[model samples]
Target chain A: MTLTPKGEARREALLDAVLRVLERDGASGVTHRSVAAEAGVPVASATYYFATLDDLFVSALRRATQQQVALFADLGEHDLRGFAEVMHDWAFTHRGAAIAQYELMFLAMRRDALRADAEAWYGALEHAIDPERLHPVRTRVTAHAIDGLLLRMLWLGEPSTVGEIEAAVREITSAISA
Target chain B: MTLTPKGEARREALLDAVLRVLERDGASGVTHRSVAAEAGVPVASATYYFATLDDLFVSALRRATQQQVALFADLGEHDLRGFAEVMHDWAFTHRGAAIAQYELMFLAMRRDALRADAEAWYGALEHAIDPERLHPVRTRVTAHAIDGLLLRMLWLGEPSTVGEIEAAVREITSAISA
Candidate 1:
């Protein structure tokens, strides 16, 4: 159903609150009541927009995916160093969003309904790597490699330095170019 | 604490039950009651052996890690083709174990106590790459790449063929060798 302007605004507010709750409390912290409180709305507002917690999670993940896509859209224009710098900066500044995304990915492993969102997120990574001038298979492998590295950094609570990021980016680019 | 042989056997049984529960029900499915039931032990036995659910989960993860390290110990003896073949077979036959491992990794992302297990798991992967004849940094990157690829395969419910695994492995070896 098409929402009115006010309805759309409220929906966005709720989605924003989902991220807030995720960042603050991790996945377990994201209850309807908590999200509603975070959004400064009645709990009914969350229930009114989202039929269940799964729906709310998917909405938030979709929003986060969109933001990531936007962030990576111009990656092709930049060199490997630039790409690495951007990613390194993002890892430091957006740890919460990154953690939430990984959590959602793990959640999707068990829930079939969330599979499409996970696939779309992977597809976005593929899209971002399209301009890297690599063979298709190489591009896919490299994308996953970068993904794994980033995941390790996040899980280990080790932020990637610019030098390390650049080295990884260079390795991928060189490997693919060859 | 030291225990009788029977006690050690029961503890192992409990840990095995944790993996079974994790595979069948996911992380949320794991509880003292559920694990005890799975193990065909009294609920009190579970609590007697493990003080809390977190303790049980960590013990299971540690056991899983030891098993993985054992599996990969001889990986350096094989060529990439052999390594890929073994991994592909494991992915198909031991899918539950793989899923549980990823689940535990995600859990470790939120809980600090599980981080060492995750690190040990990663370390095992790094050791397995010694046969690739690459620099230490290259080995580390390739390990993470293989991990990322395996995780994607598990998440997408698409088991990798030996051919696909070999190709990816060959790419990493060749990239680093060059």
Candidate 2:
């Protein structure tokens, strides 16, 4: 996937703006025109960057999932304190995308055009945890728990504060630590 | 609310079809025509019975909410047996309604007209938990967890089994058991 420098820069800016639109108004607020306005570019730029709504959505979801996977990967060896804080802070760092991602998931599940996207998104999620050698059952439940916590927190749009993050993580760890 | 026999019967039939449509098609599939068709009534009857689209959505949501509340209420006194069963038995039941409920929730959050509807739903959920008397700090977290668990298990679709439910409840009980 090679592109001109200008094209690469434009694509990055467009992706960032899509994230912004997703943040402020959720998935409903995102559109070709809106993303263009958000990126300070012509509407055609979005079409140039991505072929269809599904293309854009799937790419964005992949990017978000990669970020999430990287975030988890970098946290060495689960000290509880460090890992928990980061996990707790996630709802704060990317609240809009979290909400939009979940909303898109609903679309994926309900419509034929998007089920593959949803499946791929979930596959990325399970892959992020790497099921090898873990208690398959407990690991599956734990992943669901983690996914549920993030999505639910997004659904609630709970404002994050330092105190709130600490408290939330502590409560979460309390359940999962066993 | 008292009504003529025809009105009462129509209302009950409408609500039943509402749940059916929601379970089969997620939030987007709901429409007066669909409900009327599903219930074997004419679309004109739906229009006559429901003054507006918003009214219909609210009524359907209310019925769905009430049904869920009743289900939980029947569990009585916070014992986790049936809750566990529902969470675990996703294979047989399919998590259609769970996913549909979340979709409707997202839809409500996206628009002002619906947000009010959504808030009432959340308020009922809050009341359902009875966040008084034991561990106030943990109550909200517990509520969020429960919300997350339901959606997550729904997304997981079927791999989550009855034993998983039993184990999860045991874990939860251990954490919160004073």
Candidate 3:
């Protein structure tokens, strides 16, 4: 549904609040009441924006994924350091959001509706790596490796520093290029 | 805890039931009573085996990981086809348990207790790739890519067939070797 500018801002606030509630209490704790309370808005406001708990949860996930896609798209084509910093920020600095994003994929496995959102993440990574789409096969294979690296960073918390992450990125690109 | 052979079998059954519940109902659906009912065991048996929901959940995760590690270890070093088949089965045929394994990583992000279980998955992959522990950095970089590929399979359902998965595995290995 179309929303006014003020209405849009309120919707975004509610979405952001969903992530906070997810981070703080896990998925089970989320409800219209909890999200409204988290957003400091009326319960009616949350219910008006999100008809159900799944709507609230799914919208927040979409927002997180979109933010990540934007981050990847904004990177310079050959900016290993910039990529590393973004990776660090996503995995460590803004960790809850990253987890929420991955949680979307897990949910997508069950809900066919979210499959496109899940694929969008991989598409963003592939575009960031090869903007011209020069070599589809090579780019995809490389994207898979990088995807695995991101999961590693999130799960194991290794390549903990930006410097280390940069080094890992270098290894991936150089290995693929060679 | 030590168990008689029959007792051990019952405990394993309950753990398996947890995955079924998680697969069917998501994490929120899990409770000692639910798992016990799933296992067709008395509620007291589940409580006796696992004192709390967290205990039941974590132990099921640990069991799933152990099974996966054993699968990896059993493959012949050069058995790429076997690896592909195993991966396909894990990601598709036995999809729920695979999701449960990944869910463990999500939980690991918050609970320190599950970090080792999460790390153990990566370690298993690394060991499968480089059994002699040669080429530490190369093996790890390769592992990251392969890990990403597995996640892709789960989320996007790509490499949907064993042949495609085998081809993807070949691409990863040959690219790294080149």
Candidate 4:
């Protein structure tokens, strides 16, 4: 159902709170009451908005993915440095959102409802790598390496600086372009 | 701590129980009592075996990784089909252990104490890809792509069958070898 302007703001606030909770406590820590409290909305309002923990999580992940996809979409075709900066920002600067996205991936493994969102995340990576869809096989493999690199940055904290990350990106692209 | 044969058996049982509980309930569902119940051991035995939840999780993942590492180490150099079979079995047939290992990776993101186990996992993948450490850069990038492909298989359930998986593997390796 469509909501009033104020209701929309509250809904957005609740979704934001879900990411924060997910970042701080992982998936199991989120609940309607906790998220409502985190969002500064009434407990009733959270349930009214999301209705369940899964709703809060799935909605938040979708929103995060949209923002990230937009970031990738805006990049120039050969912007390795630009890509690295965005990766740094997402994996290090906005780390909570990155963790939230990956957590959603793990959650998606069990719940088929979240599969499309997970696929959308992977699709965005592929699109960013080859917006023109040229070299589909090469693009697919490069995207996979980039995806794994992103996870390594989060889990292992390697290529911690933008320069190093740019180098890592260059390596993958050059290897595929060979 | 040293243990009698029966105690060693009980400890292994508790670790096995942790994987089952992790697969069934995700990470947060694992507690001393819950794992003990899942393992058919008393709560005291669970706690005695693993004093805390982190201990339980880390130990189980380490064990699973060891088993997986051995499997990878046994692969012949040109055995892409064998690699595909192993991937299928790990992600599907013994699905719980796979999930349990991934869940530990998520946990390692938060806890530095678990970082070594997580690193060992990536190390195993790289070792599997190139046991002699030749073509370091190529191996690293290929491992990243392979890692990403594995995650996609688990999350999106694509390349579901062994033949499909082997074909996907071929695509990745051929793209890199080009």
Q: What are the models' TM-scores?
A: 0.87, 0.66, 0.93, 0.94
Best by DockQ: 4
Segments in model 2 whose C-alpha atoms lie over 4 Å from true places? A1-21, A24-56, A71-94, A110-160, A174-178, B1-18, B31-56, B76-81, B89-92, B110-147, B175-178
Candidate 2 per-residue lDDT, tens place, A1-178, comes to 6899999999888887877887788765778899989999998889989878767766666566566666766654444456556655666575556666677666665445544554554555444444352545444444554565565455555535655654565565454444
lDDT tens digits, residue span A20-127, model 1 = 898888777889999999999999999999989989978887788778777777676546677777677667677777777777666656667777776776777777
Sequence-dependent TM-score of model 3: 0.93
Give the DockQ (2 decimals) of all models. Answer: 0.50, 0.24, 0.73, 0.76
Q: Pick the candidate with the highest TM-score.
A: 4
Question: What ranking emerges by DockQ with the best candidate at the front?
Answer: 4, 3, 1, 2
Report fnat for all candidates as fractions from 0 to 1.
0.46, 0.20, 0.73, 0.73
Q: Provide the TM-score of chain A alone for each candidate, in the order shown.
A: 0.87, 0.73, 0.91, 0.92
Task: For candidate 1, write residues B1-178 as lDDT tens digits.
Answer: 8999999999999999999998888777899999999999999999999999878878888888888877887675547887887678667677777777776776666677777877877787787777555567677667767877777777776546889778877876665446
- In the predicted model 3, the residue pairs found to clash are A145-B145, A148-B148
Cα displacement (angstroms), candidate 4, residue A132, comes to: 0.6
**DockQ agreement of candidate 2 with the native complex:** 0.24
Q: Each candidate's interface RMSD, rounded to one decimal?
A: 2.3, 4.1, 1.3, 1.1
Q: Model 4 over residues A1-178: C-alpha lDDT tens digits?
A: 9899999999999888888888888876889988989999889999998877777777887887787788898888877888999999999998866887787767657878878877788788888888899889899899989989998898888889999999999999888788
lDDT of each: 0.78, 0.63, 0.85, 0.85
